[model samples]
Target chain A: MDEKFAAIGEAMPRLLDGLVVTIELTIFGAIAAFILAVILGLAAASPAKGFRIPARVVIEFFRGTSLVVQVFWLFFVLPLLGIDLHPMLVGVMALGLNYGAYSAEVVRGSIQAVPTGQWEATTALSLGPIQRMRRIIFPQAWALMIPSLSSLLVHLMKGTAIVGFITLADLTYQLEQVKRTAGTLFTYGVVGILSYFVFALVLMYFMNALEHQAKHKLGQGKSLWRILSPAPPASTPAGGAS
Target chain B: MIGISAAFEWHWSAAAEVLPTLLTQFVKVTLLVTVLGTVIASILGLVIAMAIRVLPRPLSEAVKWIANVIRMTPIIIQLLFASYAFLSLDLITIGVIVYGIHYATYMSEVYRAGIDSVPKGQWEATTALSMSTLRTWTAIIIPQALRATIPALGNYAISMFKDTPYLLVIGVVDMVNAARIYGGDTYRYTEAFTLVGIIFLLASYPTSLLIGRLEKRLAYKT
Candidate 1:
């Protein structure tokens, strides 16, 4: 136990460096995914086949295939055609496109989950497509999208470990180096998984806060903590009202 | 000539040479890993979901945390660790187990969602009938839960199919590994990698479409 603790202590600084890379990839990749998801997702939800077909093609191609292969393609194959991207750029692009495809479905589903009456009401208001989305439908859909997006954020955090495979010196790569030097898989593996778990917990907390705010904006109820707490009978009353 | 070859060249002949090896590995290794992984994952997930639902709160929460740790870590790292630690199993078996456990966390969530979707009335009906706990689950609840879960299970199977290439890191000699080896030998990286991508697309795209249709049908049924 003492030896294991000592090994972990020695490995901490290097692992922290890799953790920074992992966090950077998650943030940048998630931002890219979010932007692309909304665009592709809205394109998918469009009534026009011209808008929908290309979006479907892109989404399916990325989602259906393996992300590791895509990373390798970007890293190895692209340069053969004279497009030499930095390793970080390659990592971000691969993750963004891959997770973007999956999250696009989440975005499309949440948008579709909005009540039909809302769309009809918006249409009755003589709103254009952009106005209908921006002013009316999207705000409600944003709340609906939060929980699913939170899970995707967790998945994206895990997926950042793949960047280490492409030589990004991310946490997983650092852990592998520690394993090599320390010659103890158990010690390093536990530390590596715990650090990832911590990263995931941080992400979940942020997403939960976002969900809280989104729900508040949607007028679902009070803040998440208050809503989670049990209420007094006189204050809460019965569930008689919609 | 330099512009055309350097910019992009198909090398159909080289691709043709590599096809036999790629196809053999595709069926025997890639598909096998996916099938084994999905089977193990589905069973493990169902077991975990049941455990979480049945166990006492504190114990269940501990199980949940363990599952979350498994879920949040990358499969490549898990594969590497398993390859190192579980030396008794062959590399491919280790690959399958690691993939199964990694995705089992996702699958458990799906199962949990399905179980949660079971109507309260159904639970009350089972209780009212004084059904044994085992009987209540087996007869009343699990059938309904599994009906809702099958489509999602199929979706994850498709996902596991794509993720099989990560087995290469553990020296599983999966199709992607085979492709890399072929590419290295022939110096035809483009043909080898592109063919591998094409093969993955061919298998997964059609299956994904089928899964999409399955999801639609399931949704309509519900």
Candidate 2:
């Protein structure tokens, strides 16, 4: 047990390095995913078949296939076609494309969930298509989609474990290294999972704050300040001014 | 690296040669794990959902906490932990159980949502009729919840099927692993990995379509 603790102590710097890589992959991948999701989602929700068809094809193809295969294809096969990308890039691309496809559905659903009254109101105001979506539909939809997007973001973080397969030393890979040196699966495994759980909790808390802020903007939920502060008495009404 | 001319070629013959090996592994490992895992997940998830509803507050909270931790962490690490911890168990068994339990957490959320969707009136109706707790669940609550849950459960099964490739970490020789093995031997990765992707698309796309249809039908009925 003492040796195991020492081993873990020795492994801390390397584990921290791996955690940094994992965080980088997740952040980059999320940016890529968010961009693709909005584009594909808007396309899918468009009135034109021209826009919708290709978006559907991209979304479905990516959604249907496994990420492991996609990552491997980019890593192993793309080079054969004379388009070699760094493994980190491949990992990000695969993660982004896969989760982006899933998030596209969430985007489309939330946009459609916005009431028809809002659409008619936009039309009544003579708002152009881009203006209507930008000024009205998207903001409402954005608030609605944040909760689902939060879950997907967490899923995307967990999905970063796949990077280890392609030889990126992410947190999971580092934990495996720690296991080898620490010579105990139970301790390292518990630590490995706890670290991820902690990261996930932090992410959830952040997303929850974001969600609260969005809802607060739309006049639906409590102020961010109220939510962050100490809880009030049980008899106090929600959204009341402090 | 070998020249693009030699490496990038898509030979139908190489694909055909690799197909049988990958397909065999797909049936033996991938499909088997999915079927068993889904079964385990479906049953366990319902139990968990019910336990959360009925168990005392602290105990239910504990269960929920465990489930969230399991759900939030990557399945790959869970597979690794299970494989390492249970050395006596074969990797395939560990794969199924780990996949099952990992997914059960997600499915429990689905089940919980479904159960919550059961109208309060139904519970009130059961109580008014003096129905036993088992009968209230069996005849009133579960039937309604299951209808709402089936399509979502199908989606999770498909998700699990795509995820079975992660079993490669535990040396399970799943379809992707079989393809990787074939590619390792022949140095022809494009055909094998592409075929695996195609196989996944073929298998999952139609099922997702069916699930979409089922979702629509269920919505109509409700």
Candidate 3:
């Protein structure tokens, strides 16, 4: 027991280095996913069949495959095309691209969840497409996306472990090194516990903050959900449910 | 170790030599694991979801917290912790316990959502009829819940297949590990690793297509 505790103390600096990589990956991944997903979401929600179908295809393709496969492909196959990127770049790019695809639908769905009346209002006022989105759609759309987006961030943080697979010295990789040197179960637990500590803290913090922001934003306007004809409460009255 | 040299020139001869065993035994192990993992995951997941049903609001919330805790942890780490942590302690039971527990959390959420989507009125109707709760859940709630959840269960199955690689770390010698051995043996990473991923796609793609169809059917039904 004491050995484990002491090993954690000794392992702190190296793990902290690993933690830095994890955080950097998480932050970059979240930002890239957010930006790309916004574009993806916009493309998906577009009226043009040309735009929407391809975007939907990209979204499902990435969403369907294992993320580790994507990372490996980028790390290995891209160099065959002379893209010879750094390992960190490869790891980050893979995660961002893969996750961006999934988040796109989430973004598109949330934005579309806004009532048709809101779109009609913008159209009636002669608002351009961008203006309609920026002013009318985004503010309310953000509220809907917040809960899911918060969840996605947590997943993104966890995804940093895939970096370890790419031979990057991320938290999981660091833990493996620590385990080899320390050879103790306690040290392994410490690694899980520490990473979990950082993850849970960031996750809960982001979620709560978003919850606060969502409440504040939605508190002001009469909701689009309200204006869209509300469904009856309780599926108990549900019909034709086999 | 197969060493570094044989890994580069990965030969058909090597893969071909392994083919007889690969075709039969690998398929048996793969199917065994996929089925076992899915069944155990479904059962455990339902139990966890039922806890949400029976538990008080605060307790359900606690269950959600536990679920997130599991969800946030990587499958690889959990597998390692299972094989090493428990095995070292002479607790082999803990390995299955870890997989079942971790996967169960996600599975439970699937069940919870399905159960939640079941009209609240169904429960009230059962109460109105003075029917036993178990009978009501069995006859009504779960049937609907299972339908609602089949796509999700299919997802779990695919995920479990991909996750077999984690077992390699625990000395389970699944396909990924098998390829690694081939890569090491013949100095041929290109073929072995590529084949392993192809095998994964072969399984995952069809399973995913099935899920997409199931989702469409459910959406149409609703």
**Cα lDDT, model 3, residue A107:** 92
Per-residue lDDT of candidate 3, residues A155-190 (tens digit): 677667767766788877788778865664655555
What is candidate 1's CA lDDT for residue A13?
95
CA shift of B100, model 3, Å = 3.7
Ranking by TM-score: 2, 1, 3
Which candidate should be chosen as best, given DockQ against the real structure? 2
| Better structure of 1 and 2 per lDDT | 2
Docking class of 2: medium
lDDT by residue (B85-201, candidate 2, tens digit) is: 899999999999999999999999999999999999999999999999999999989999999999999999999999999998888899999998888899899899999999999
Ranking by lDDT: 2, 1, 3
What lDDT tens digits, residue by residue, belong to model 1 across residues A32-52?
Answer: 999999999999988899999
TM-score per prediction, in order, is 0.92, 0.95, 0.80
Enumerate residue pairs that collide in model 1.
none
lDDT of 1: 0.85
Chain A TM-score for each of the predictions: 0.90, 0.92, 0.85
For model 1, the interface Cα RMSD in angstroms equals 2.7
- Local error of candidate 2 at B79, Å? 0.5
